[model samples]
Target: MKRPGPLFTLLAGVVLAGGIGITNLVTGTGVTPVAGAANAAGAPSATEAPRTEPPKTAPPKTSEAPKSDAPARADYAGRVEGGGASVAVSIRDGHAIAYVCDGKKVEAWLQGVTVGGKLDLKGPKDASLAGSYNTAAVTGSVTAGGRTWRFTAGPAKKPAGLYRAAPKVRGKASKAGWIVQADGSQVGILTTDDQSAAAPVLDPAARTATVEGALVVAEPISGVDGAGEF
Candidate 1:
């Protein structure tokens, strides 16, 4: 015991070499032993390599975002006849309100004019006025007292031959016999021999007779001698 003073025999041989290196790290062939031996190293032996918890990081693939070109709008109504006057025009939203009738009277007289105004229609181009009336198929023209009289859109055709008028005969009026449709009824029997007959009066009358010529007199005759028969 007195010799054991070599620093107590080098601390008793470093405590018996740390108790035989902790009994060879607790059995099974050596070196691993950090308390629970890293939880019984049996399953956790791969140390740093067992830290492979990174495989559960599948939260990065996310993409779905793209769409926008911009362009969608519409609303429309119609009616735009033209420069002689037939304007009822009502465009809305884009604004274009017009109404100035004369084409047989709807009578707006020019309310809410808009769209550059000044639709005076033109009429003094050497007024030889016989039957001429066309403002441009009907959209607007014609002013009258202030002078813008451009009347058109009335006759497309049909106004060339026979057209007498005894109030427009209907029926009843037969001496030499002639009164087809003015409400009198009795169509036929005047005969000078022009040849072309038709008789069935009343209900819109229908009296006509001829030896040769009869362009069109449908039902309204009175001209046996007053110089008006055809």
Candidate 2:
């Protein structure tokens, strides 16, 4: 047996190292790619941005609308179709009261319960009024003295509505009604027993009227008060 030279030993070592490398590759234990190895080392990669879920978004909000319904309390005044008469209506709760006058012999006081802004009122001598109302106005037709007329009445403010006066003048039964128009005009009628004539001027501030020679208190008619005594 002879000793191997340094060159021969070096050659043998090189061959052994090559064989071990091939065996590692075949056994699935070879060094990975630089990029893959770095990724596996738990370092964040430029190609893979930090996984961030899209910002959670909330749905848009909505506002609720107010409810629309018939008014619980209201007063309206207007003229008839031909302007031959003035009409006034007052409503409180579900009850309604109305008055129509020509400032002459044609006059009526009507009352009834309102249903869903609809009015169907009846008065003396077959007088009747039918209509529908809203927050703005009332539209309806009235029948009296064998005649019918359509009318539209707008909202009436204070000092402009229906007024009534009942007092005994010269010991006789007497009654008066006034309709203060929205345009500052007015019309009314006074009745004593079977006679009818023009009504006296009514002072809204004082709520009074002078009848013949006597000063009488004028009551504002309202559906709340039922206007029953009228």
Candidate 3:
């Protein structure tokens, strides 16, 4: 016979190698073919390594507004919008007292508690005052006599706050309200028998006033430890 060609010789070598591998697997002898042997031999692997995820990262934190301390005792006085009325507020130990006066027939007394530098007070005739306070000023609105007005009041010194006197006139109940401003000016009113009029001048030094021919003391309406003198 003629000598075998190169192709036939190569085919014989391959078959011999495959037989040896099969023998190794069946008899547990010699190096067995591993799952990724082709990949190790520089061919692409049919089964790739398990896909790994990148390590998880945490989210960033957020910013917030700074907190402030509440005021223990403070006084605020200011005028309503359009100079239509005057408002005075006093806060002590978290209690608050407010007065809105037009220096004439329109006035209201409001009382409530102060929380987190804010005040919400109510009174007769659907009167109400809502506001916020700080070291610099108190700003908000007041409603009385079916109308509402906004205001801003700065820090008030002593003798510059709300005042009142409720005395018996001729065995009948009478009431007076006053607001002493930071500029030493004053606005007040007297109400008796369902009638309102301008109030008498108050003696700030002694906190006294003469009403209906009777000597009565005008008491400072402090938010501290005392109910308002209606």
In order, candidate lDDTs are 0.29, 0.86, 0.84
lDDT pick, better of 1 and 2: 2
Prediction 3 global C-alpha lDDT = 0.84
Of the candidates numbered 1 and 3, which has the greater lDDT value?
Answer: 3
TM-score preference between candidates 1 and 2, better one: 2
| Per-residue C-alpha lDDT of model 3 across residues 50-150, encoded as one tens digit per residue | 66899998898787876755577777777877897889988888788888998888999998988888889999999999989988888999999898999
| Models sorted by lDDT, best on top | 2, 3, 1
Ranked by TM-score, top first: 3, 2, 1
Q: How close is candidate 3 to the true structure, as a TM-score?
A: 0.69
- Model 2's C-alpha root-mean-square deviation from the true structure amounts to 8.0
User: Highest TM-score among the candidates is held by which one?
Assistant: 3
User: Could you estimate the TM-score for every candidate?
Assistant: 0.16, 0.68, 0.69
Please list the residue runs of candidate 1 whose C-alpha ends up more than 4 Å from where it truly belongs after superposition.
Answer: 1-3, 11-13, 27-104, 107-230
Please tell me which model should have the higher lDDT, number 2 or number 3: 2
Tens-place lDDT per residue, model 1, 1-230, is 34456788898899999998888778856764466566665666545465555556666887876432211111111122443323222222222222232232222212221223222222233211111112222233434323343333321111111122222223322222222211222222221232222322222223233323322344322111112221
Off by over 4 Å in 2: 1-68, 223-230
